[model samples]
Target: MEEGKICRTNPESSDQVKAVHMLLVSYPLQGHITPFIKLAYLIAGRGIMATLVITEFAHARMIASEPDLGNERNKVRYITVPDGLSEDERNDDVKLSQSISEVMPGHLREVIEKVNMEGNQVTCVIADPMFGWAFEIAETMKLKLAIFWTSAPGVLALILSIPKLIEDGIIDTKGSSKLDGKIQLSPDLPPLTSADFLWNYSGNQTPAEIMFQYFFGIHQNLKRSGWLLCNWFHELNPLVGNLVPNMFPVGPLLASGKPAANLWPEDLTCLSWLNKQPAGSVIYVAFGSITVLSQHQMDELALGLELVGRPFLWVKRSDLIKGGSSKYPDGYEERVANRGKIVQWAPQEQVLAHPSIACFLTHCGWNSTMDGLSMGVPFLCWPYFADQFYNRSCICNGYKVGLALSPDEYGIVTRHEIRRKLDSLVADDGIKVNALKLKDMAHRSISEGGFSARYLDNFIQQMKE
Candidate 1:
């Protein structure tokens, strides 16, 4: 494996091999980028020429860290482009999403044209639907395009229901979801309320305004898209994907060979930490990057973890505290010295897969949900925002594989409450049983003739056609 320029697999080619080339463009965020890179690796390994287009920051970081992208035969070409952002603005979630949506289209078009100039054809654009501008560019170029929605199928169903919601007067022209209580999206599904709306933004914040507009734009642009590739399976949300036409449920897109884009340096030291613990004993606590807990919330969490009095590995971001100060009380670490390992980040997939990890206190992000599901870990769902609430609903209400934490009046999970949930998660065998069954179904989906395998095959074949 060598690094300098990305290359096609072989110099010699046939017309058939040249016929199928794909360009995958995801939003410049960890959640969107990781799975698409995994999808790129999968597509390329299946003997198609696939290029993963990412922001310059992500491209540089991943290239320096991962060797799999440079390996032979199953190689994916990397197209690095300006994110129209800076080092500082990268952490500003609102601006980053807006910027990626604005800048990526021109950069992506350049890659498409460059590939054409090289005498190879780029037949399709598999884009993360967050950036709807890709829909316009691909339409103008007349390239076959698929909306690679990275969230759950149920989330997609919610997005698609916007027009109907407006028409039914359940909501207004603005994206404000107004309802007194839960309403059924379908007969088979559980009820949803105003709370489960993906971008249930309060009034007049610019970022929230921008995000609402982004979702509306996605709704409009996706109308022209003939193919919708969901990064989930039929087992998860059979109704959501099937209700919508040309929907291909093709995932649980697990990392197999090439490690998907990891921005944070994973502390592999955690593996050794797990080895010392008894099987199914350590609590794996990680909220995905971008979730910031308030200072009080952070303080309460620390007290709660100590109260659990169990071995735990907690991934704590430096900016987790609101006032930018340590939330832990004096002598806290010494008191729980051998009981916990708190780092800035850990290799989450590996941590979730570890035998000693008994329960996962997760943010309920799509990737985290999938990782927990695939690994058969019982979940303690504590969602902060966005699709997470819905994902939590799916976990706790839909699948019955998790327990939801009840927050106090001030929206904080009190120490005693955390302890109780942890106790329930540890004591409950039914949830664990369901989690294991879901894990087996997830594994079987990627096996021969399984749901993911068949649909993924269909999707790639559509790319060729």
Candidate 2:
């Protein structure tokens, strides 16, 4: 870890420097950026000086949407870096992993040099796992860099196993046929087939190559950091977290007992509809910002929710349709108008917190899954890509907190399977009891004296050391 850059020439002015200054770097994608911002708010609100680094494009969106975050801008100051992407490439069209791989390292170095020159002096950097060059930036600045997986511990464990899988000759560039049947890699982890580790849709590398490179990068980076932080709590991943001791489970940080911070506007207004339903009466579905669905899949999904007959809130982003406007079948919205609330996006935290949200229908993106678990809502996992399938298995089997949706050979799930899982999850009395129990534990982890709280305290202390 590196010490701060000296800004004040006057000895008297040296006293003005804040002891804890953090430069928070995220993967620039919406799913990755929002949670990191929330965590930065929690840290800044607690008296630490924090600055959030964003790409030139995201910087504009933040100021326009969330102006009051910092006195500097939104409580979290901004540093704009060039993404090496043109305006056309900046849209949601590019794949996330591909976008990350293509990002230039020059802007990140420039941001560090500029920060050192400005003299605010960063003590440590919290870097997203996907932002691969952050370790190099930390090395250059000599600052302690901590990696935030932004995913669950179970996913981390599965990713960590990639190196071992390669050594065992179970995976290769083309992928393995070993996943054709049930397999148990970890004694304590859920029974997962090889498909769980498959990279599926990430554009940069094949499934096997992606898993190998991602984990290889993660392990090497961990040795350089002050400590690692996960957005999960002990109650949700006690077994895995304990196995990986240096990793801290410090989150479920949204709407954390402090007070509601409405950074993003409440679109969709699904809460009003949630209020009208009975406790645990609805299934909330959101696959996060990047997961796109085909027209056939969406229609099947609609038929599934309709078959379940439970009230539901589903986020259908403008880009969600793969072939664009033609994806929505004739009268699709009208067909589910009575039971489903179809919105572009919903206030996720509020929707999850609502008592009516019984189960979450998700793609297992780290942030969304953590939010749902933090509220103690069980899941119906429909993982789209990357480590999501691994995460889905972890939730469904590792912790028994959710159920997995098994699709057909083409990876397309039918309405019958969806309805079967939904009824089994929401109707079972044990699921609700388990959900409430998990929720209580999640709250405790983020509370003042909880495990995650203590872990965060120790992590900061290491940076000071």
The TM-score values for the models, in the order shown, are 0.93, 0.85
* Best candidate, TM-score: 1
* Candidate 2 per-residue lDDT over residues 149-174, each given as its tens digit: 77666567765666666676666544
How do the residues 131-191 of candidate 1 rate in per-residue lDDT, one tens digit apiece?
6788778889989989888887667777788888889888777777667887777654667
Q: For model 2, what is the C-alpha lDDT against the true structure?
A: 0.70
Q: Report the alpha-carbon TM-score of model 1 versus the true structure.
A: 0.93
List CA RMSD, all candidates. Answer: 2.8, 5.0
Candidate 1 residue-wise lDDT at 331: 82
Assess the local accuracy of residue 4 in candidate 2 as a C-alpha lDDT between 0 and 100: 23
Worst 10 residues of 2 by lDDT: 1-10
